[model samples]
Target chain A: MEIPVKTPSHSYAVTIGKGILREALTAQHDLFTKADKIIVLTDENVWTAQQSYFEANFPYIFEVHVMPAGEKCKSFENYNEVQTYLLKQKCTRKSLIIAFGGGAVGDLAGFVAATYMRGIPFIQMPTTILAHDSAVGGKTAINHELGKNMIGAFYQPEAVIFDITFLHSLSEKEVRSGMAEVIKHALISDAQWVEELLEGDHVTELPEDLLANYLAHGIQVKATIVEQDETEQSVRKYLNLGHTYGHAIEAAAGYGRVAHGEAVMIGLIFSLLLSEKFGKVNHQFTKRFLHFAMENGYPFEAVREFTFEQLTEYLLKDKKADYGQLQFVLLETIGQPFVQKVELEQCREIDRQLRALLAEV
Target chain B: MEIPVKTPSHSYAVTIGKGILREALTAQHDLFTKADKIIVLTDENVWTAQQSYFEANFPYIFEVHVMPAGEKCKSFENYNEVQTYLLKQKCTRKSLIIAFGGGAVGDLAGFVAATYMRGIPFIQMPTTILAHDSAVGGKTAINHELGKNMIGAFYQPEAVIFDITFLHSLSEKEVRSGMAEVIKHALISDAQWVEELLEGDHVTELPEDLLANYLAHGIQVKATIVEQDETEQSVRKYLNLGHTYGHAIEAAAGYGRVAHGEAVMIGLIFSLLLSEKFGKVNHQFTKRFLHFAMENGYPFEAVREFTFEQLTEYLLKDKKADYGQLQFVLLETIGQPFVQKVELEQCREIDRQLRALLAEV
Candidate 1:
């Protein structure tokens, strides 16, 4: 199936299916045919696991550059290496880049394409379920020593080609991490989807068709938010529903140690904990969500490892933080997200409450 | 005087006047008051020359990051240092960056602003005559190891404040280097302006008022083209009239050793040499322009240092070079610029002619 995204700066589509890499790319032949070259930027893990499959199915002739896996691929050093590689390969404005891994590779490759020759055409061939969210949105970045996604651009891709056959190789931890974003989409956009998920089988055990459906739904939710606010000047803040506290946890854990979506899942509960007092969300629902998260083995142990004060340092560095005020995306109820300026004092209070709740669970 | 630049991504103004840095910034009080912090990215030379004047005129408290002078400021190591500085200074998305120097400083700072937190607002405070052209359009970049501007983004600035008072402190070489771009602006836009420049006193010796007028005219020409083609997808390529060969020589000379616009002046002569054969441009006119350049001391000596063979490697690496075909911006006549795909053999012919003519002069 195909989902179209229309932003002020770009208009592209997300083509998602099982074993559709060759067909999807062939469909977008015009984007490839115009390019003087095509470069596939992947990571060691993804390339090692899926190179043969990719090579067999990728219709076009292209060169490939393998990077260190996970958040390491998003570092400033890696970002520079990719550009140097492109320069060495003589990639030009006409060159089309294929971001051929999960979120890390997508972020790094998207950013490289955005800046290479002041911008070039690129497509997202996302290999992980986590990338269902990232690859669709044009938020490309490299990490600064001080923060994640700190140095980057809102450069959209020409298309996002998600061939789910690649996801067959994901580890259990990867599946749990990827599902957090899928769950995040459900939580922010549809209460019915959230309910279905809460009562469903293990997140990693979702049937193939159901997994694709959920991924498609999550992408649609993200695409709608992104279309409304391409640069996150306004409505797009809602998409960060679980990210405020989530990113702090992720950053404090030093990235990769706590997977991005895993930390986001923890943050989802943190937002819910805050939502209880600030919005119409019930303590009962927050508790049930916590129960759901625990049963799914979302690592809440990482939270105990860092004190709120330590996490607070990273929290203040958030891109969404206006001045010193922490801006969070909190649910009025499931499916309705709003931005709120929470003081450091209230955040500390919620952090304390979250720990107490996690201890009981 | 104000020239409005209206590009699809942005709309800003070029405020050009003598000694108006204080007033120009004051007029944009809204932009200032909104920024949580202000960062001034400049070079040692510029800060030393005009720090007192800037501090006296600037209305706000700003942290200054004085970098190594010239192209050194745009190196990858320095780009990383500036980001670390901003992170240390706790600069958030609300922070505003002041690109307060010539083209190099503006390019570096503009790029920093472009990527920091996925972009922050920035203003160009040009401290030299050449910046009247560079400061206007939002072409921000850093130099890669392989090529100049191989790494960058097309990020627009909020406004470009050209305080020509800063030019009073420039050295003779800086003056000559800067006038080349102003001359280029005239060449691509107005035949009358070109004739006026040809008949005028030595470029660096023009009356202060006349210099300001010429800069303003150059900015207008640039602004118009940028409004139409901000990304160099169309008419904007005309602005790169001499940059193909100019960048080759600039890169061949290893940056800082040769002033950018000086190399451009040499490339301008090369382009005119090409136009004589390919367009209606007369050989006599090219000679007259060369004579004008000599009287103004444009340093054609830089060109003699690198042969066509030596420069060919860099020329092939030109951002505009596609699949070994050189894309040169040539004039059909004065004020009428068009893009042409010239082969290497023809480029060699032009190189020979340029050398023979330079030897005569």
Candidate 2:
């Protein structure tokens, strides 16, 4: 299935399906033909697991730079290393970059392409279910010591080629992590989709076709929001439904520990709790969502590990934070998000409530 | 004087004149009022020389980050440091950045603002004459170990405040370097302007009002071309008339060793030599241009310091090189520019001619 994304800066498409890597890549012949060199930037884990399949199906000669896996791949050091590699390879503005891993790899590679010679073309070949959300949007970044994704750009890819075949090698934890974004997508765009997910099989055990449908649906929600507001000036804030608090938790855990989607899952509940006060959202729905998240095993225990004080530092560092007030995307109801400015004291109250709910559950 | 630059991505004005900094910055009250924090990113040299003038004129409280002077300010390490500093200052998307230095500081600061939290508003408060070209174009970058401006983005500034009063602190070499671009603007836009410049006083001894006129004229030439092609995909390539060969010489000599415009002066002559062979340019005109360059004290001796073989690596590394073929913006006539793909052998022939002309002169 092909989903078209149109932003003010550029327009491209996301092709998602089973075993579509070779065909999807082959369709982008024009992009490849113009490139003086094609560079594949991936992580050690992804490269080791899918190297042969990628090489067999890519249908082009390219150089590969394998970085350390997970959030480490999005470090300042690794970002610099990848740039040096491109320079050594004599990559120019006409050279193309292929981001051939999950979110971390895509983020790092996309940013590298965005800034290398003041922007080069890059394609996103995301290999994880989580990337269904990340790959479509132009939000590319590397983490700073002070915050997760503290440095980045809203540079879109020329195309996104997501072949579910690559997901076969992913661990169960990765599936659970990826599904959080899918759930968040459903929450922000379709109440019926959220209901279906709540009534469905274990997120990790979903049928292959069903998972692909969810991924496509998530990309569509993100694409629509991005089209309206590419720079997060307004409507795009809805896409950060769970990320503000989620990033704080993720950053507090030193990144790669809680997993991005897992922390976002935790943040979904936090937003729901805030919604209960700021919007028409009910406590019952928030509790029900929390129950569903716990059933999927989203490491709520990580929240207990860090005190509200520890998370406060990271929370205020959020890109969404305006002045000292935390700006959160809260739901008026399922499928409707609104931005709200919440005080630190109110956030602490919500933090306390989350812990108490966790203890009771 | 106000000149408007409208690129497809953004639109802003360059406010140029003597002592215009105070009034120009104050006029941007809306931009300043909206910013949660205002940061002035400058180099040690600029801040040391003009801090009092800047502070007294600029009617706002802002945090200042003073970096290493000159090209050293564009290093990857310094780029990282500037980002870190912004993060430490807790600068959010609402923050405004002031790039208050020459081309190097503006380049570094603009890239930081471009990528910080995925871009924020920045104003170019350029201090040196060299910045008349760099500040208005929205081309922000930091130097990579492998190449100058190998990593950056084409992010436009909120406004450019070119205060000619700042030029009083510049050295004679700096003035000569800055005038090379003015001459280039004239070469690429108007033949009569070039003739007048050829007949004018020594570049360093030009009257103050005339220098300002030349800088404004240079900016208008740049603004018009940039408005046509913001990212250098088409007509904008003409703006790089002397930069292909100029960058090679500058990079070979090491940045800061030979001032940018001085090397561009050398590149201008090289382009003229190439023009004599490939276009309607006359050999006598090329020689007269070379004589004007030597009389004005451009460092042609630097070209003889590096052999064509020594400069070949940097030449191939030029961002304009497509699949190893050097793409140069050559002049068809005094005011008409076109791109040509020249082979290494032909380039060597022109290098020999340039050396012979310098020796004869």
lDDT (Cα, tens digit) per residue for candidate 1, span B1-361: 9989999999998899988888899999999999999999999999999999999999898889999997789899999999999999988889999999989999999999999989999999999888888888799999888777888999999999998888989888889889999999999988998999999999878899999999998999999999998898899999999999998888888876788889899899999999987888999999999999988888888878988899889888888877757999999999999899999989999999888998998
How well does chain A score by TM in each candidate? Answer: 0.98, 0.98
Q: Which residue runs does candidate 1 get wrong by more than 4 Å?
A: none
Best by lDDT: 2
Please write out the lDDT profile of model 2 over residues A275-337, one tens digit for every residue.
999999999998888998999899999999999999998888788888868899999999989
TM-scores of all predicted structures: 0.98, 0.98
Interface RMSD of each: 0.8, 0.7
Model 2 chain B — which ten-residue stretch has the worst lDDT? B312-321
Model 2 residue A288 CA deviation in Å? 1.8
Interface RMSD of candidate 1, in Å, is 0.8
